[model samples]
Each structure stands twice: as structure tokens, then as C-alpha cells.
Target: MSGIDNLPPLREVIATHDLAAKKSLGQNFLLDLNLTAKIARLAGDLSQSDVLEIGPGPGGLTRGLLAEGARRVLAIEKDPRCVPALAEIADAYPGQLQIINGDALDVNPLEHLTSPIKIAANLPYNVGTELLVRWLTPPAWPPFWESLTLMFQREVAQRIVAQPGGKAYGRLALLAQWRTDPRIVMELPPEAFSPPPKVSSAVVHLSALPAPRYPANPATLNRVVAAAFNQRRKMLRSALKSLDPAIEDHLHAAGIKPTERAEQVHLEAFCALARSLDS
Candidate 1:
């Protein structure tokens, strides 16, 4: 038992479906069953959780989620070509696997999914960061999903978990780290993907915090972080000049320096700056 319902091998499934990964779609199929299972495990016990999988190309990760006993798997794939391929898994798993053929950006999972859903996906490179942001900043706290287990290009993954004063630290880091504890759980070589990408990839698992690390209006923090990192080399006072004329006062109130660049500011300081603006 390859831990599934004796379905055809993923390679054969690709050949039968002629699922040639399209560059326009940012497709890179993870045909490795072992790795897929590992990703499922990293998401913790999915036995009682409904799993939301984005861009499940050929249902590689989808199968693993099901095999690991996810109560149900809602596999969202924009590419119509992969829908039928996913249907086969749906049949094998009975009612556990649900395939939705549409753009992930357009679908609001909150409106449909019940509480305690865990998201696990090998997201498309083009839209992964944007989707993660959308999930992280839903006007409401504790946005639906219990956790997120995702794969991204190694460099992109680093940015998501990067620390202050690092080259990769920027808006993504602040946004992700603010409300969740994120870290890279596994790394994948370029060769691990079908139609391997130029850069290596890694898996990031983020668990939501009951509340944000610090208190700041979400909109204000977003604007502040964007301005500060928009011209990362410039000092915060200068980079944020376009947003507010009294930027120095806000920085001083936050106990941050006018000469500090974006990367030098930590999450707490950014929250302070944002709060100061509203004060």
C-alpha cells in the first residue's frame, strides 16, 4: 500500500493526462509521494481537519492529505486540465476529495468552509505570496484556517521567515510574522519538481497566533510597512516621507531612529510606528 487506494503512479497519471506543466500558470508538479506525505505530517494531525489545498497540480499533495486522514480535502485548481485528473482521486477517496475549478484569488474560503480548516498546498509561484497575504490579513483576527503548510521557492520562503536586519526581510516577513509563527520545515531541490524551476524550493508551516504579536490597526501597519520597504535602502524617515509629513515624530515616539532603514526595524517597532501614526 503506497498509502493510497491503489491508484496509478503519479508519473503514469501525468502521462495519461498529458499534464505538461504550463509556464504561464507557474506549474511545477511535485510527483513525489513520500514528500507529499511528509508535508501532510508537518501540518500535524489532519484526521479531523478539513484541508484546503491550492493549485494541487495533478493532486499529488491532495492524495497525501487524504491518505493521512484529512476529514475532507477541498483541492482548488485554476487549471481546468488538472480537474479531471483530480476527479480520479475524488472517486478513489469517495466523498473525501472535492475539486473546485476556479482561480484561488477569487474564491473566498471563509464564506464556505467551516472553522478548523488547515491549508496545505504546493501553491503556484506567481500567486503564492499574494494568497498568503490575503489569508493573513482578513479584516478579522484568527482568519479561518488553523494553520498553513505551503511550498515556495527557497528565496521566497526565506523572505516569509526572514528576521530583522536581513536582506530578505521586508513586507512579507512583517505581515507573516506578525500574526503567525512561521518557519521553513523542509527544503526541496530544483530536481524534485517536474519541469524543475531554476531555484530550489522549501516548505513553510505557519501556525496562527490567538492575537497579533503587537497591537496596531491592520490598515495602518500595512501602509507603514509598504512605505518603509518601498525604498528599503532609504531611511524610514525619508522612505515614509510621502505618507506623512510628521514621520520623524512618529519614529521618535516609537523609539525608532530617523536614520533607520526598513530592514533595521523589527515587528514590534513597526507596530509602534503604526500606532503612533494613529495617536
Candidate 2:
């Protein structure tokens, strides 16, 4: 039995169920209970929060969330083969665990979760970035979840928390840093998973700010950031000229140099540009 609970160890569980990590699904099952519990702890105190977990293959992290005392856990697994294994976890936790066999991208989790929600997952590789972008760019401020504790390939994690003037600093850095306080909280080698991904992974903890770091319309900010980074090598004036006839004037108004490339500009300056464009 896994030390964290009465449930069978993940390897045994996977073997019994004939559950192999499928490359198409981007499944790399994290088999260590201790590591899973540590990841759950990184989400902070879950005693009062309902957690929404995506792609919970073999229920390893689900058990950790439960063993760590989450008030409720809503797990969405796309693979039907893993549902029965998760069902066993639900049986052990009684009412605390709810398993939904559906695609996380299509399913609206707000329906199953309560207020003061937190999202914790070893997210599927294929859909991780898309899901994160959707969460970060919601129409409203102070989104459905209070925080996000998620695992991503190290490169992607770096992009999420990257600073200005780095190769990793681009649209993702601006987007995540604009609305949330994101940091890399842990790193794992490829061997940490069952089949093991080619790239190393890291866990990012993002606490949603009460409001954006600076004021800019979300749609405008996204558009401006996307445009700037799409041709990052070109000077802002040249690259953004298509955006407006007087793009240089807007850049000057936002206190940005017209000749600067996208990577050289910081988040605040980008927000200022968005505001200038909105005006």
C-alpha cells in the first residue's frame, strides 16, 4: 500500500489496470507518493479549498491531495481507461473525491467546485499551455481559482515566470506576470515519472492577484503582447507600425523607445502601451 493511504501503490495499480502512459495523451504518470504529497503541500493548505485536477492518470496526485486533507477534489481525466482506477480512490475517500471522465478543455469546472478554489495538477503536456492561457485570460479579474499549482516541462515553466531581456521572456511572461504572481517552486528530473518525459519538469505556483498588476483592458493587452512578440527581432516602431498609423507616438506616450525590440520591453511598459492604444 502507498504510505499516504490504503490504496495500492501506483505501479501495482497501473499494472492491474493495464494502464500504460499513452504518448498521444501526453501522459507521464508521476509514481512517487512522497513526491505527490510534496507537490500537494506546495499548493498550500487545502483544508478549506476544493481542488480541480486535470489528467489525473492512475490517481497518484489525487490520492496525495486527499491524503493532505483537501476539502474536496474534482479530478477530470480524459482517458476512460484510468477512470476505474480513480473510482477506487473515490471509494476510499468517500464523498471527498469526485472523478469526471471528460476533456478538461471542454468541461467547465466551476460547476463542480465551490468558492475559494485552488487548481493543482500534473497537467497533460499536450493541453497544458492552452489551459493556462485560458485561465489567465478570462474576461473577469479575480478568476475562479485562488491559486494554481501546476507541473510543466522546465522550459515552459521558465517561460511563465521569465523576466525581461531573456530568451524565455515573451508573451507568456507578460501574460502570466500581468495577472498573477508566478514562481517556480520545484524541479523534477525525467526519471521522476513512470515512462519519463524527455524534458525535465518543474512545478509553478501562481497566486492570483486581486487585480492586474497595472490597468489595461485584457483584450488589448493580449493583442499588444501577441503583436509585439510575433516579430520580436524588429524594432517596435517597425513591427507595430501595422497596428496603428501612429504607433511610434503611442510608444513614446507609453514611455517606451520606438526602436526597442519586444524582449527588451518590460511588463509595465507593455501595459502602458496597451493603455495608450486603448486611449
Could you estimate the TM-score for every candidate? 0.97, 0.99
- Which candidate number has the best TM-score? 2
Residue by residue across 1-279, what tens digits does model 2's lDDT show?
779999999999999999999999999999999999999999999999999999999998999999999999999999999999999999999999999999998999999999899999999999999999999988888999999999999999999999989899999899899999999999999999989899999999999999999999888888888899999999999889888899999999999999999999999999999999999
Error of 2 at 267 (Å): 0.4
lDDT of 1 by residue, 131-208 (tens): 999999987998888899999999999999999978999999999999999999999999999999999999999999
Which residue pairs show collisions in model 1?
A: none
Error of 2 at 121 (Å): 0.4
* lDDT (Cα atoms) of all candidates against the true structure: 0.91, 0.95
Best by lDDT: 2
Model 2 residue 136 lDDT score: 95
- For each candidate, how many residue pairs have backbone atoms clashing (under 3 Å)? 0, 0
Q: How far is candidate 1 from the true structure (C-alpha RMSD, Å)?
A: 1.2
CA shift at 275, candidate 1, in angstroms?
Answer: 0.9
TM-score of 1: 0.97
